[model samples]
Each structure stands twice: as structure tokens, then as C-alpha cells.
Target chain A: MVDVPQLVEQARQGRPRAVARLISLVEGAAPELREVMATLAPLTGGAYVVGLTGSPGVGKSTTTSALVTAYRKVGKRVGVLAVDPSSPFSGGALLGDRVRMSEHASDPGVYIRSMATRGHLGGLAWAAPQAIRVLDAAGCDVILVETVGVGQSEVEIASQADTSVVLLAPGMGDGIQAAKAGILEIGDVYVVNKADRDGADATARELNHMLGLGESRAPGDWRPPIVKTVAARGEGIDEVVEALEKHRAWMEERGVLARRRLARAAREVETIAVTALRSRIGDLSGDRHLDALAERIVAGDTDPYRAADELVEGLTNGA
Target chain B: MVDVPQLVEQARQGRPRAVARLISLVEGAAPELREVMATLAPLTGGAYVVGLTGSPGVGKSTTTSALVTAYRKVGKRVGVLAVDPSSPFSGGALLGDRVRMSEHASDPGVYIRSMATRGHLGGLAWAAPQAIRVLDAAGCDVILVETVGVGQSEVEIASQADTSVVLLAPGMGDGIQAAKAGILEIGDVYVVNKADRDGADATARELNHMLGLGESRAPGDWRPPIVKTVAARGEGIDEVVEALEKHRAWMEERGVLARRRLARAAREVETIAVTALRSRIGDLSGDRHLDALAERIVAGDTDPYRAADELVEGLTNGA
Candidate 1:
């Protein structure tokens, strides 16, 4: 058995392998995860998490890499969690992005890991926060979470971050698409990537117009800022970082940062609790208690509500 | 307050308004949901649920309409639940599809309702099953659950059905797309709709090849049949229906139907229990108990697991 304290100590000392192993424990739901989490708990809360989400071809990975470079320039320790919710196979969708991110592979100050949903019950909802915890405890000053696709999981992961960045490219009809994906509300910083492409100005204007359309914000409320960039060439990346810092400062000034972190922590706790309860329910199925209840429900002898109530009662009382 | 029993009774008599009201209650999570579900429980288990799912532009609504007509011609009362998981606003995305289903709207024997997720915590996972229960108890012979999009929720809804029909259209790269969507395993029957179009045969061939690639089924295993259909003209629908019946018969012969229903009921009960527990957790937030725990977690005084354990313990014991 791996020593949880030793592993966590190594991770906290900027050992990438230890950090990766801890995240592996999180992803695989390893037996030592609870111990690992406890060991790292007091060491966390230093990393600022920024979530980047967009449709494929919006240059999420490029932007993420560029952000890493910018953060590293300030001598800040960085971590990247490239989450691909669509791929059942971990690392498959991120293979090319991994190659692009090789520039930071040799940098001990940078830690990067790719995660997929892997058909987990809650998908990223349960896993991402734990993975983020791993990075935060590993002494990373800033963590960038870049997720592909605009699906429900992406929206969910975005909201869990300390700051959310919604990325879009020109000529993709992304302004309306962003609204449709429900990311517009979660995004604190929006990047119009591929700014060198045609329709860049048009897209930015349209996004600005739409972002303004639905509103009643107080004078002091933080309005999400839009930044334009050609992430491929690292152009306008500093401005992107600037925008992120400004948003972070604004959140801190208004006490939103602490509130967001508290909310995020609550959600994380809830997810873990729910997952544990679900597994207990799964155990009931293995013992045929759930099966028997389900059989009665199928037989119309009891309603699902009543059967569920009994099940919940048994669980609560039995525990 | 509306009388739950009266509404359920009217619903049982095949009153469309009563059916719609019950579904609305399910969507809104009305206070009388438990009573309504109890009254409807004995009346359910009769409707054979057929879940049809695919990407947009695949003529799902058209095929569903055709199926409704076919079922009605055989003197079978039909219910159609057009679920749009992508749409946050209820019935917004399905408005056009509802208009197309107007023919059945005039027929009292047929009940059609468009349901969007409405941003519920579990989205369709919590609502769809309840709505299906409502439809099943309303004396429908078969309930067609047509959901748009190939997201996780769609895959989930498809698996919940007694028989899942995955729709694909020619020239849409649908065969590969279907496999990528993870619907390949959930489908009991696959329909290559718009069979009159070019590449229909190719799509079917590719789909067949892909379906066979990773399988080593026993002799008696039910192989999902792929049916070609021009649903707009109602062509090849009978064969689709026949395929469905054959699959159903196969499932029944092997007792798979009972097992599937039992498993589905188990899931439904679990979802309800989990949702209830989640609300209790939400209540903890209002009481600032969860906030205190979250604050501890954010302050790095405790890990999420231990905090979650305390929260769960409080919930179980307090209840």
C-alpha cells in the first residue's frame, strides 16, 4: 500500500508524479482516496481555479496552454485539468492537446492532467472537484480547468470553478450558441478567440449586445468582460490573464470569492455524500432489498414513492 | 387545492387535460405528487414505453407521429412525451414539433405533451419517469418518449424505456455519430429514418458493421434490428413496429422485460430518494448548517469527506 501521508507530502513539495498519482486515486475512486483527501485537506485552498469551456474548435486547449505560459512567467505554480466529458475513454480525446501542451511538460512548476467522465454516475460533477482538490493541495498557485464541448457537464464544471471563462471563435455563430449552452451566466470572463479570423469584430459586437440584453445589474455588480485573442499565436493572452485577474479582484472585493468557494465546497461535500449514499443503495441492490422493492413496484403492490420512502427509512435507520 | 384523486380518475378515463395536469404537477414538483403517484401506481405497468432518441434533423418527431397513427389505427390509445432536454424553457424547443403533432392533438385517444427539463436539479432523470408514470396510468397502451439531442440525459432516458429506438438519417454521418453518442448499446431497435434519401443503405450497412464489431453474443441473444423507414410517408413503419414487437417478445420470452422494468423501477426509486435527500441537504444550507460545514472546508480545517459525513449523519439522525 502506498503511504498516503508520504504521497501527499511529495505532492505538496511540487512533485508532479505524486500529484498525478493522487488524481489517479481520485479518478479511479481508489481505496486510499479518503486518507489522501484527509492528508491534503489542510494544505489546500491556495490555488485559484479558473474554468475554460467552449465548443470544439474554439481553441480551448490553445488558450489553456497560453494561460499556463502567462502564469508561469510570473513564477506561479500552475496545474491544468483538461476534462473531456464526451469521451468514455480517458485521454483519447485529449491526445492532440497533450502534444500541444508538451511545452510545459518539462516544467516542474506546471502540472497537467487530462480527465474524462469514464461513465461515472455523476460524471464530472463528482470527480472534477476532487481532482481540483488534488491540484490545489499540490501547491499550485493557479489551476486552469479546460473542458471540451458545451454539454451539461461542461456547464456544471464551469460553475464549480472560482472563475469561469467562456471561449468562442469567429464565424461559429457562438454568441447565440453560448446563450443556448447556458454558459453565458456562469462565465466571468469571455474570450473571443481566433480574433484574426473574419467576423471577429462582428462576433464580439453580437456577444456584447446579447450579454447586455438580459440584464438588471447594480452599478457595482461585476459585468463579465469580453477579451479578443488569437490563442494559437498567444496574441492577446496577457489581456485574457488581465481580465481573469480583474474578475478575481472584483469577486474578492465584493466577498463573492469567499461565497463562491463556500458554495463550491458545499456542493463538493454534497456530491460526496450523495455518491456514498448511492453506493449504499447499490449495496442494497446486491442484497436484493432494492430488487424486492422494485419487484413490488413493478407488481403495482406499492407506489415508487412509498417504496422509495421505505428504502430511505431503512437506510437512515440502519445506518 | 385541486383534488388529486379526481385528477387521477379523470386521467384514467383518458382525459387529455387531466393527463397534462398530472404531468405538469410532476414537472413543477407539486405538493400532491406523492398522492397522485400513489393513485396512479396500480394503474401503471400496462403501457409499453418506447423511447426514441437521436440528434436533431433526423425526423424523430415525424417518426413518432407516424408511430402514433399506426398504434391508433390498431385501436391502441397512445401517449407521446416529446422531451427536449436542451431547452431550459418548457415546451419552447418542442413547439414546432407539437404543431406537427396536431393531427393527434384532435384525437382524444391520443395524448401528446412536450416537456423540457425546466432546469430541475436532476433534470429529466427526476421528472421523465414521473411523467411516464402519469402517462402509463392514464390508460395508454404504448407511450412513445421522443427526446431530442444525444446528450447524457437522452442516453439515460433511452435506457429507461422498455424498448429504445435510436433514429438516424442518411448522409448525416449518423452511423458513426450514433456510436459516438453512446446510444449504440442502449438501443433495442435502430431505425434509419428517411430511407428514400441517398446513402440510407450505406448508413444501415455501416451501423450493422459497427454494432457487430465488439459483440460476441450467444445464439439466443436479442440482436437489435435496424429498420429502414421514410417516416414522412409512413413507409416501412409497420416493419419498424414489427421489429419492436419482436424485440418485446424476445425480452418477454427471456424474462428480460420483467428484469428491465424491475431495474428501471429500482432506478426510479433511487432517483426519488436521492432527490429527497438532496433537498434536505439544500435545507441545511438555509439553516446555515451546511454553510458552517462549507466554511470549514473552505478554510481547510476539514476535508470534504469528513464534513459530508457529518452532514449526512445530521440529516439521517435529524430525520
Candidate 2:
């Protein structure tokens, strides 16, 4: 008996509590999700999404705070979603991260939420896209999707952004490690954070070298530019922002942005359908339907592939 | 044309090349996968799956090598699948890991294959289960599935294991860190590798103390035991193996093994169905049918959720 219109109205007005509640509903897979999305749909596509990701301890939080400050200076409303599946950082380092970003805590123009995707069925793969939708519809002018860790999460986060920023620190080793980890592939703008350190120039040089070695770009193709920033002091952030703007412009001019949005739309639709199908499977799995199939497989009466087809067929036909 | 039964037959004989080819077919989503799996299904259920995972530098490779040697000494044919996402470590560190156990590398009783799940759709998440089936069908008495990195991959690996061994080392901080990472929840048996290092006993004591604080076990409930080992020296590996065997026996006696296998079967079938549906969506999404829906979304004609339903409905009904 939730009033979807009222909640959507409040979220459109940038009420933090309403926005949080909307996200919770999305996370919980509430029955009213599609209706809610439909209400919020027309209001979206305004916010500029920037995804920041890198290895742990690479000053991602500091950089995010600096970028928030920079954007707020221009009078832009901001939303931040910090995704951490490891969950350790969410408690302590998160507190420290917020403490540093607390200057804007009461601004109301800024919204911040931490997402721990562990132990959840859809995890970040599903919840993040919906969360982004909520933020976009809530009238945030700019949304920052930040992810931590060195694994596939980086690529996944980068895929969600209109512009992706990959940050690295000096003395954390060379750009070769980042290349090896596939960070280089996703970066739209590379930042050498903590640039005051001794190896900053070296790190920047290494990154430039690697960027040069990439599948030889045509003359007009956008090469990921390296920006040097000591995010702690908020130095050189303008250059980072400039690079993001450049990439956005490039994507738009090439009609890549339109295609990207179309692809994102298609992907989101597919995911929603898949998630609904999975839920159907879960519901049908009750009452021993799935248990019977599993028992047959365990008894060697049928293989899993044939059994899966049977289950899918049974569920589809009955529905 | 693919000879599914012949390939499965060669794989069942424990031929390494045939095993590699079978896994490749699975990774590539070969058209004959269902047939191949059907042929191999009856030959499975004999191998004991042990999943080894932890944070980097915790000596998982060494511990796995030690376990392999211990099992080999007892005349068990072992299948080792090292899941390195990029396939880099399998050649270098894998050799180092097997240095002590190299004596058995030349023995026909041992089978080792490294799985690089990167660049494949669903990657290790989907491919590992099928590869485990291959190893299981190949008549390996014990199959060790080893994975690297932290985060979602850890949980996926744990789900595939009958026995999940979470390896740790001294100076990696306290059990609190592991608990924070959700590792403590899924571990069937805990091993503190590099026991010769300083604070080894302290690490063990801390782990034991933490394990004691977990949900109180009944008189017969299996509590995960902490075993200390200098894996490089192969010290205490026998104890680790003993603990694994004891846990297996306890699970069997309590009928948990049957329940676990049944659950595994159900999950595998569900994953296969979901994967198949996803491929169907991927195929249907091509040719701008999805693009038209996305254009409507971009133009605010509809929301993504509704568009997804339309796409799913069109595909499902047409099929």
C-alpha cells in the first residue's frame, strides 16, 4: 500500500529520506519497483555520471571528495554511491572517508550512501543500475559512482559511467601493474593522485608510455589523457574535470553517447527481465518442483542440462 | 560436427588434452555442451571437491600443493584446477607451487589444468561448475578447485565447494579482517599457512577465539577447525587432510552430504537456465529491436522496466 507517486514526488524534490527509501525499495525488490521506475522515468537523463575506481588505498575517497567540492563550487547538486563488496571499508575507513567529506554533509545539495553488496542475491550487478536510475530521477546534476578493489568490479563500475576515471598513486608500482589488472582498458581519464610524491612523474611517464602503446589510435581518436593531482590538497582537480568534459564532448560528437545510452537501456531492460525470471524460478522452486528435478539429477536419472531445460520449460508454460 | 560422446569418453579416461578441449568447449559455449554434459553426467559424483581461496599472499598455492602431495601419498588420484583469471600465474607460480609435489606431476594419477576465465561471458562463475564436472567425471578421486582474488569470486568459489578451505597467514592482521571480508562465514576448514613465521600461534589463537564466538554449535555440529601449517615445508598438511576427512565423515553421517549435493544440483540447473535465457536475450537484442525500445526510453516514451517486459514478451512469445 505504498504511495508511489508521493514518494517519487518527494524524490524529485530532492528529499534525502525519500531518496533513501526509494533505493531501499529497489534493493528489497519490492513489488512496486516497475511502477516506481515508470514514475521516475521522465525525470531522469539529466545527471552526468562519473565513475571512479581503482585498487584499494589509491585515495579514491579523497579524490571523490575533492571532485564533489569542485562540482559544488559550480552550484551543481551531487550524489555519491560508494560500492564496497568487501564490506570492511564500509564501517571504519568509510567513517574516515566521510569525516573528510563532512564539509558538505549538511548541504542537502549533496547526497551520499554506501552500498555493501555482500550476501545479497542480486549484489551490485543488479542493485547499482537501479540505484543509478533513482539518483538520476531524483534531480542530481552530477552522480559519482565510486567502487573500490582491484578485480572485475572496476570494469563493472566503469561500464556504468558516461566517463570513467582510473586513479593511481606513485610508489604503488608502475602503470604495468594497472595494465595487467585491466585498469587501463576502462579508464577514460587517468589521474596520477598523490602527485607530490617522488615517483609521481615516473608514474605519469609510465602511464603515458603505456597509453602510447595501446592499439595504435587514429589521429582523431580520443587517447586517455593523464592528469596529475594531489587530491589531499585538491590540487590539479580542474584538469581532471577538464579531461572528463573532453571525453564527454568526444562521446557526444561521435554519437557514441547516444549509442552508449541505448546500450545501457537495452542492458538494463535485459537485466530486469532476467531478474524477474530468476524470481519466477525461485517461486516455482518451492513446493518440491525443483527438488524433484535435483533429486533426479542426483540419482543420475537426468543430467543438469536436460533438467534445466525441463525446469525452464515447466515454469514458462505454467506462467 | 562435434563428437560429444567421443570427447567425453576421452575426458573420462583422464586425458589432459581431452580435458583441456572439453573445458574450452564449455568456455566457448559450444553448441554440443548439453550433449557432452549428458554423456559425462553419470561419470560424476565420485570426486570430492575442495575449494581453496583467500586474500593474495596468504600462501593458498603452497597450501594447495601440500594438500595435493598429502592426498597423492595416500594413493588418491587428484585433479587440480587453478583458476587464474588472466592465465598468467598458472605457468610461473603454479610451477613454484608444485615444486615440492613435482615428483607426482609426471605420474598419470595426477591431472592439473589452469582455467583463465577472463574474456568469457559468465566467466569462472559459469565455467568452473562445468569444469568441476569434467574433473569429477574423469575419475579423479579428489578435485581441488583453487581461486585467487577477493570479493564476489570468493563466494562463487565457495558455492562450488563441498569443503571450502580459507587460508590465512601471520601478520595478515586478526580474524576480524577475515570476518569483515565474509570469508569466515563460508570456510569449512581454516588453515593459517606459513606457521613458521612470528605470531603464528597468536594468529591461530585469535582465529580459534573468534571461531568460538560464532553461532553456538550443538553437541554434534561441525565447528570449523583452525590448522597451522608451514605449507612450503609441508608441515601439518597431514593434519589438514585429517580435518577435511573428519568433516566429510561428519557431513555424511548427518546426511548433510546428500542435502548439500541436492542443493548444488538445483543451483547448477538454475544457473544453466538463467545463462540460456541470457543468451536468448543477447541474440534477440541485436538488429536494433532493442535500440528502438531504448530510443523510446531516451525519448521518455517509456521506462526501462516496462521496455524490458516488452522485449522479454516479444522474444518469449515469438519463441
Instruction: Pick the TM-score winner.
Output: 1
Best by DockQ: 1
Per-residue error (Å), model 1, residue A261? 0.5
Off by over 4 Å in 1: A85-90, A93-97, A213-217, B85-90, B93-98, B173-177, B213-217
How do the residues B113-206 of candidate 2 rate in per-residue lDDT, one tens digit apiece?
A: 7776466666567777888888888888999887764546646766558888888889877466567556767778989998899989888888
* DockQ values of all predictions: 0.75, 0.63
Cα lDDT for residue B216, candidate 2: 79
Please report how far candidate 2 places residue B200 from its true position, in Å: 2.2
Instruction: Give me the displacement of residue B112 in model 1, in angstroms.
Output: 0.9
